[model samples]
Target: MTLEDWGWSPFFAKQFRTWQSRGLIPARVIRGEKNYFRVWSENGELTVRFAGKIRHRADGRADLPVVGDWVAIESQPGRRGLIHALLERKSSFARNLPGRRKGKGRERIEQQVIAANVDLILIVCGLDRDYNLRRIERYLTLVSGSGAEALVVLNKADLCADPQYYQHEVEGIAGKSVVQLCMAKDPEQLDFLFDYLQPGKTLALLGSSGVGKSTILNGLLGEQRQKIGAVSDAVGKGRHTTTHRELFLLPLGGILMDNPGMRELHLWGEEEDLSESFTDIEELAIGCKFSDCAHKSEPGCAVRVSVENGNLSSSRLENYHKLKDELTNLHRRR
Candidate 1:
């Protein structure tokens, strides 16, 4: 496949010119480990290590190459290749390191890049008991901030009698984003997903365990490429099937990045995305009498009024306020 088929575009092309002039070749990082990466270049897949300069320049984990990153590489005669530097990302999905401790008072939060340069994020949610609207909102905020379009994929539809019922609930929260329903166990049910999976496009499968992410991955590949974990009948949660993030080329010409199901997604910055994800509340805020309406006991508060009128769910508003406060605290710490 050509570079363009691997999701390379003019945005990355312009930035890669400098590296090309330096006699380094451009390669897309397919998989990344602690210190090494598997990249797809003109000569095919190559095992590459970070150059000394790159290591010295990197400030943190985000500065290094992650899956779906394009980098400049120097090939040695017989030894492993060296990655010089990473090109600027068109979009990146990141979050605060889960369960990592944070220092108080002005200490910057530790963030980890989940995937870089993703074009779309398939927020897979199961129709089973594992489904939670709040969890979907958290994933939406993360993807919306990454500059990638979010598509809510409701998998395991067979488990639920009425998939449309769940679809409507997601649409209410998703706003402008599309919500798709499918049963990963039945490949025929997943045919509709190909409409969004075009050639050269990159999509990331994101959801919690037992949400059928791995099953969906294998479905798209038309084979048992990823191992599927068995779900517990009592708890309805699946074991950690995918242990790491990986990029797979689809038979239909799209690139798919399958990530390990996150137990908790602690959001970082991207307050604007938070506003976008909750446009319903934002629309109501515009009609508020005060420019800065807290929506608590404020006079002529459209948001609270909507909540009272049954037009908006109070839980959604509570989550919005909670996330807004979290971001506000982050900004103050910064």
Candidate 2:
């Protein structure tokens, strides 16, 4: 497929003008492995690596090219392509890097970009034993600042006795985000997803392992393109079916990215974005007596009153405070 057919648009076309003037070719990263990448350009698929200057200029892992990223490359005959620069991303989904140790007592918070230039983030959740409202809230918080629209996909609906109940509950928590219910094995139930899968758009599937990301992707592709794994009875979790993130071209004309289930989604965003994710709590805080009320022991606190009056779920409030504290700590660590 051509670059445009792979979800490229005027946003990237304009960014590549300067590199084009220098005779560099524009390529979109379809998959990334270690330091090497597989990109789609005018010349078709090519193995590419980051140029030395590009690597030197990158602040950290977040600056590097990822799946769905567009880059300027210099192709060599019978050799690997050199990626000189990464075009500015129209949208990016990232999370705090996991398992980094403090070298000397300095806590450094680093970010890892999940996907670049995605138009929509499919926050997939299984309705079986894996479904949890708190987990969905965490995913929403992680996607709130991602520039892309977040769409919640409640997969495994056939397994749930009352799918509509779960769907409505998620919609209540998701606010402006759209929520859809479907069983990946059932093609008819998956039709609601097509409205957001317009041609030229990119959608990333994200959820915990065994949440049916691979199954959903295969259903959309009308084939077993992604390997599916069976869930274990002991742990009640699905095996890590998808080892890495890969982009696919849908037959109906859209870009789909299937990502490995994220076991931990450490948030990486501004503290203010939390309000956007938790509008219900944010709205309650406005009626608080103190403008800077901590919502803990302050007087005239609408938030605490809501919890006491059974208007707000205590678990939701608890998670909001937990995430807010996490973001505050992340900032200080950085």
Candidate 3:
């Protein structure tokens, strides 16, 4: 397969100029294992590990290679190679990881890079017990800083009495992002997803466990490529069927990455990043009396006023404040 089939474009091509003269070939990381990674290059798929200098030079985890990152590799014997360098990413998404305690009474915050160079992120939510507006808000906020576009996919429409109602609620919160509803069990219901797929683009699935992420992947792939697990009837939650992150090339077009369902997603960027995901509140904040007005208990707060005037949902505002405060606290600690 050519590099374009794996989401390579002029953006990445420009960054790879320096590595071209060298013997190293550019490769996209498809799967990460315990001590090595599986990558695809012009020479075909190869099992590789990064050079020690690559790890020693990395300042943190975000600087290291992750699935979907294009890297410079030197081929070795037996379809094996060494990742000599990690090319710059055109788009990436990360979350705040609670790190070990640093000193007295405090823990450090670290960024965990989820995926790199993704063109789109599918925020999947099930209509069953997995449906949560607040959780969806959190996911959108997490996707805001990533250069990739976000699409809210509400799966399991069969489980919801009126999936359109939830879709509308999501559209209100999605801002410029699109919201789609589908029953992953039926392959036809997923036709809308293909419109966004293109040969040189990469899309990723993000959601909590048991949210039909695998079902959607299987449906789109036209095969049971991923193992599907049953959701617990007692807890109304899905088991961890997918344990790792991996990339797959679609037969029709586009590149898709299926990730292990995330139970908790923490905001990792600056508080200002909220403006993109919470555009409604940010637009209303423009009319606030004070420039530094915090939506809470402030006089002439247009955001809270909208909630009172029925222009915006109280729950959405509450989640905005919750996420804002969480990011503020995280930045303060940093």
Candidate 4:
């Protein structure tokens, strides 16, 4: 397959020109293991590890190459190579990695780039107890500023008698994103998802544990490529079946990255990311008398007025405040 089939485009080609003279080839990182990464170059697929300079040049883990990244590799004789540099990503999503609790307010925070060069993100949410509107908002916020479109895929329709009810709830908070319900085990119901897949495009699946992500991935692939784990009937939660992040090229087209279930999603982004996820609140704040009103107790506060007028839910406003506070605190730490 050509590099275009692997989601390469002019964005990467422009960056690769300088490396071409050095005999370095452009490769797309598909899967990452403990110490190395699996990448597909023009010659063929090869196992590769980044050069020491790559790590030394990186400011943080987010700068390191992750799944779905396009890198310039220095190939060896064998089916292996060394990654000398990471090409600039067209789009990437990251989260705050949990760090040691050094102290109360002095806790260390680090950025963890989950995937790079993605075109779309499937925010999978199960209709069972795994469904939570606030959690979905958090996921949307994480996707904001990543330069990729978001789709809220609510799976396990059979488990919830009123799956549409959950869909409606998600749509209320999903700004500029469409919500779809489906039974992941039933491949027939997943046909609409194919419209989003195409050559030179990449998508990622993100959600908490036990959201039927593996089931959905398998349905799209039309095979059992990734293993699925059982959910605890008592806890109504899912097991961390997918342990690592890997990208798969679809039989038809497009690339899909599967990430491990996240137990906690510590955000790592600017407060502006909230504007996309919390558009409703952001729009309402536009009418506020003050430009920098926090909507807590500010006079002529449009957001708080919406909550009082039943235009917005108080819980949603509270979540907006919570997420805003988290980002503000993160900026302070950084």
> What RMSD, rounded to one decimal, does every model reach?
2.0, 1.5, 1.4, 1.5
Alpha carbon deviation, residue 119, candidate 1 (Å): 0.6
Ranking by TM-score: 4, 3, 2, 1
Model 3, stretches more than 4 Å misplaced? 102-105
> lDDT per residue, candidate 2, 1-334, as tens digits?
7777888899889988999999999998988898799998889989998889987898998888899999999998864699999999998888997564656654467898998899999999999999999988988888888898899999888889999999999998998998898888886667888888877899999999999999888888999888999889898798897897899989988999999988888889888878988999999999999999878899899999999999999889999999999899888877
Poorest 10 consecutive residues by lDDT, candidate 1: 98-107
lDDT of 1 by residue, 204-232 (tens): 99888889998888988999989889988
Query: Between which residue pairs do clashes occur in model 4?
Result: 210-238
lDDT (0 to 1) per candidate: 0.87, 0.89, 0.90, 0.90
**What stretches of model 1 exceed 4 Å from their correct place?**
98-108
TM-score of each: 0.95, 0.96, 0.97, 0.97
lDDT tens digits, residues 1-334, model 3?
7998998888878888888888789999999999999999999999999999988999988999999999999999999999999999888899998856756656778889898999899999999998888888888888888888999999999989999999998897888899999889998889999899899789999898989888888888999999989999999988898998999998879989999989779899988789998887898999999999988998999888899999988988888889999999998887
Q: Give lDDT tens digits, candidate 4, residues 1-334.
A: 8999999898889999999999999999999999999999998999999899989998988889999999999999889999999888888888898667656654578888887889999999888889888999998998996878899999989999988888888988997899999898898898989899999789899998888888878888989999999998999888898999988888879888888998888888999999999888889999999999999998999999999999999999999999999999999989
Model 4 spans > 4 angstroms off? 101-106
Query: Who is ahead in TM-score, 1 or 3?
Result: 3
Candidate 3: 10-residue stretch with minimal lDDT? 99-108
- Which scores higher on lDDT, 1 or 4? 4
